[model samples]
Target chain A: MKQLFVLDDKKRTSPIKVLLNVLLVCILLVAVFWLSLSAINVTFDFSFLGNFQVRIWQGFLMTVFLSLASLILSLIVGVLSAVGQNSKILFFRYLCNIYVGFIRGTPLIMQIYLFFYIVGTAWGIENRFIAGVIILSVFEGAYIAEIIRGSLLSIDDSQLEAAKAVGFTKMQTTRYVILPQLVARTLPALTGQFASIIKDSSLLSMIAVIELTQTMREISATTFKLFECYLFLGILYLCLTLPISFISKRLEGAFNYEN
Target chain B: MKIEFYGLVKQFDDDRVILKSIDFCDDIHTLAIIGPSGGGKSTLLRIIGGLILPTAGEIYVDGEKVSADENELQKYRKNIGYVFQQGGLFRHMTAIENITVPLIKVHGYSKEQAEERAGELLGRFGLLEEGHKRPAALSGGQQQRVAIARAIAAKPKMLLLDEPTSALDPEYTTEVLDIIHELKQQGIDFIIVTHEMGFARHACDKVAFLCDGQLMEYGESSRLFNQPETEQFRTFLGKLLEWNV
Candidate 1:
């Protein structure tokens, strides 16, 4: 009975393997740090971070707000655009196609600039954060649309037929059957797109948005510690992104029906 | 319930005719549609279930004409229970959830009521233990049982089965056939498109033979199988017998 609980060799992680993996990662990290410090001749001190902690924290909060807002807006845009692309109406399908094509073809930075300088100005939108959110949402919405469309297409035609056979209206079929499956199928892609959104929030610095990158740039300029400032910025971005990646992975596993 | 198809014509691109002008009306509790591959057997079933629209035709279920408009079709479809050959149970839903969805969503049963009904159906179908398992986790036979349970959950006027046991092995096919037989005894009307000749002969009251998108012959199962009126049906039966042997 005791033997029944013993893990098979394939399932077990040997202590030696675990120790070696940890050792390798430590060595690699140390080597990179030493190399960077030696090459730049910068002191390995993060003391300057304390002075700008509040500013950095504020910027971090803004970044989170921007990402979450853009993510929600983009998801709405994505689902609508995907549905438009899939619509039986020729005009709607073509319109969605043009939107997806134009966004995907142009550079995201260029789009942001265009939106801020021209569209926002024309619309009398003065707030930089709102403008940034709009730009990011539009940019990410196109890619998310494609992701959603691909996921929706991946569902078998029989599923739709089955729903119809059971007397589910087109709307009911989409809401109850297609949407649930689509959420599961697109969760990983959606997560990746969200992480991209967080990283892209850094681009708002160009438009004078007081996000993490902009704050770090200000700190570096005042202190003349570019490398250290950039390193902390990188760590800050990781702090924002790593949790999203981890949680989404857990969600992906939980939603996985294929297994 | 009586089902009637009047001058049913299905054509694509003004050239390929899947079904030519056909008129059929029958009062059948269990009708078996048997035909060669590429015949309009599945298409006919789909048309009846409102999954496909006929180019020129009228469908009457229980003497009420089924309209072509989407909303009207949906209302008409509510009275139908269609089962596909592949046992099209939602892969993400458990067997019980598959049955409960129509009950809760379409029929407006409360969650608890739907679950209770689902449990009763699962128990009736010998799938009580498999209720929590998703379609992927269930055997082919079990999935088909769940599909049947889901179809009949709404208590539709009639059930349409398209090759319900085609994907199952002999043992599983027998299991499904047994369930179908039991359902028939319960006074449920069924229109089945099937390749299982033995089950069709034994279970169905009427048999319709289709070939090249045309209904060649249709009559009582005893007369159609034992003393076929058409040469096409005779040849088809000979081939089926040879293959079975």
Candidate 2:
């Protein structure tokens, strides 16, 4: 049995600090809840939400559509860029490095602006969904590339050497041996990247996509109930994200090496 | 039917020559190359396996010159199976998948036949129980055994091993050597680079010594181990024996 020394030691590292932390968290929650209730004029009536559900449903569908489209684009870009980044030849690495650097170094907001206003107008593609999809995918692709490259790098060198020794052509080695492990190892990161994309989809409201946040904005403006609309919007966001977080956590646990 | 190297020279970047004028021929059952570190022993094996070409020299496998035509060397390579120091099992693949990769990728075997043969070979090696496990989940000895099984799964004519048992424990090393001996009984030729002098003395049909990319000595294993000829070979054994003593 392990000793309870850490719990017993109270001077520098005590349970008091933990108690204080919980107390602070409770106090912050109470303050926020109180402000929200008073500001929204709490009336215990959810009738507005009943009428609002239809628009919310449509907006949620659009959000899903945008997220799925962006995710597919991001995956393609991420994989290609990662392969390019780790290419044996120097020129390919340089090309991938410059692309990743240019995308990641700039702010996502600037990228959105470039896609929505500059490129979208020039190309005459006025579909906000298309512009939003392109912007989010390009932005998220940079981050996904790093995650993929990291997973690929983590693979053992002996693995590739073994494939070669077994008389696998380079393409065969990658297709059969390297790719399967790469996909498995990067799954959790893929989920995290998808979650980030969902959250960032709120940025589409600026371009008038009428996603959930936009619907909430329209409701709050009309009702003059900023706190109520946002409170419900927060609940909707939680409903979407909580399941993703729970599933990803379960995946991580299931695949954990318990040895 | 014969492989010989004449005036073979290899250098990494024109500065440090790893192998120089290595000249030898081996038509024996199991020929072992044993030498100290950085002695270009593995370089000789790699060149023989046709994984790398010598910067200057001629290598003939079965009377076909390797350096004369690049395409000819590739055809010769299909007959050789090289095993690395590490088992080098692909982590993503189970034992069966790893074993059958050569058949599917190189020999164009149908997946069903390849998998069936893989299962049979793995069963022969007493690894059927672990056929579904990935390399990461397997023990070092088991992974190496699986590697050996995979190497021979395609039924190559010659096996080239580079320090196959160096990373294994003493017991595992004996197990691997036992497998090699069993393969020798079936008349499969092997060019092994290893540091296990005991195996070199007992199991090998012939032994070759390499130093600074040169063939120091080559003879029957019993004669070479008992009565080493060259001064360099004698001195090398003297130091190794001192360590063992």
Candidate 3:
């Protein structure tokens, strides 16, 4: 038993042992959930999946489209706000600061309603999908800006001085010294934020956006199969985000320099 | 280089005076400012490099007043090179790129011209093979040498090195000092803040000893090292050389 736990100098565990342990842990997780699910009065029925296939597929596609569109828009907003937060002009700095502060201080669900009902209505944005994407983009943009700003602040003052000493103009310094370092440090966090954007878009179901969650909600309401719908919903989300988290982990390692 | 300072003062946060009033002048091809740490040596060097603005003072370098305006400062900085305690090389860029990028971007050299000049400097500094490596991959001495090469690649009017070898081992320190000696022989003007007393005494023409926010002594390096003045400087030299072979 002791030898089984002990590793050789290389510290490499046997592949067979690792695989077996992983399988056992997965089996244990499923068993626990199955035991609870069996004890509950609710019956598990995925038969409705076949009946509502088209609606669910469309909802999943909507979620993907919303997350993808918001990801790109949020990233643009993030880079601008992050750089703006460090701007010499007070107006740019304060605007970025207040945006980040307000979005972070309040809840996202409140922001979704307020933006869709008040701001979106005021702006004549009648399409629920467009309003939902805009709201999600605005919300995620603030968090992304904070992530970028944190990495920006972590850059050494010496780097700036070195650039100045070499006579790099402000624009050139941003292009050469600041941007490369910024990309290297912030890429992983930004990728992780995309995962958050996917999860957060589910809340747009509240506004009747017809996304995956809304489709599932509608289906469950009619079928009275809440648990089955939600359980399958989680599996579908994992299918999207599990690969993202894996990529995020790989990116974190890829950017790791010894310095 | 004829350099003059009139009532130079630098304070941080209005309360901490890193440099009390400083008035000094010197005309030397190679100058070294040496003293204990936290003695305003690096701060004085930074003001000379136009990287920092003194709170109250006027500086004249080679009969030209170093102004605090942004445009004038950028122009002034354009003709000078500065090396910080760390190499301050872009960590993401390879050592050669560290030298070439600045030359191409800031100095307006073509990419080929920049690469040629960077290659020459790397070879001169014995970093030709290490040129492909980033600062993190290079050794401390290599990083500092790359910094020195980067600083001199544009052939600046003056080079300001703030303890370039402070982070290196004794072996690497000797190597960096040797490069400075070669630069001195080549007759490129420089101002260095260093703790290596022997290099200060031998390699440099003029020496300024700063301690406790004041310039206590300034003279020819040979004469000053041989015959010291000021009780503070005398004690400092004694303590420093006491451990020497």
The DockQ of each candidate is: 0.71, 0.39, 0.67
Candidate 1: where is the Cα deviation over 4 Å? Answer: A1-9, A12-16, A88-91
Best by DockQ: 1
Which of 1 and 3 is ahead in DockQ?
1
Q: Which tens-of-lDDT digit does each residue in A1-259 have in candidate 1? A: 4334444576676676667768888999989989988897767678978988799999999999999999999999998999999999999999999999999999888988898999999999899989999999998999999999999889999999898888799899989899899999999879989999999989999999999999999999999988889998999899989988998899888898775
Q: Please report, as a residue range, the 10-residue window in candidate 3 chain B with the lowest summed lDDT.
A: B12-21
Give me the runs in candidate 3 sitting further than 4 Å from their true place. A1-15, A41-48, A80-98
Per-model lDDT:
0.90, 0.81, 0.91
lDDT-based ranking = 3, 1, 2
TM-score of chain B of 1: 0.97
Candidate 1 residue lDDT tens string, B5-115: 899998878578889988998788999999998888998889989988999989888888889898888888888888999949998888898989889888899999999
Give the runs in model 2 whose Cα sits over 4 Å from its true position.
A1-47, A86-95, A249-259, B67-75, B110-112
Q: What are the candidates' interface root-mean-square deviations?
A: 1.2, 3.3, 1.5
Can you write out model 3's per-residue Cα lDDT over B115-141, one digit (the tens) per residue? 999999999999889989989999899
- The alpha-carbon deviation from the true structure for residue A125 of candidate 3, after best TM-score superposition, in angstroms, is 2.9
TM-scores, all models, native as reference: 0.93, 0.87, 0.92
Model 2 TM-score on chain A: 0.81
Model 3 chain A: ten consecutive residues of lowest lDDT: A1-10
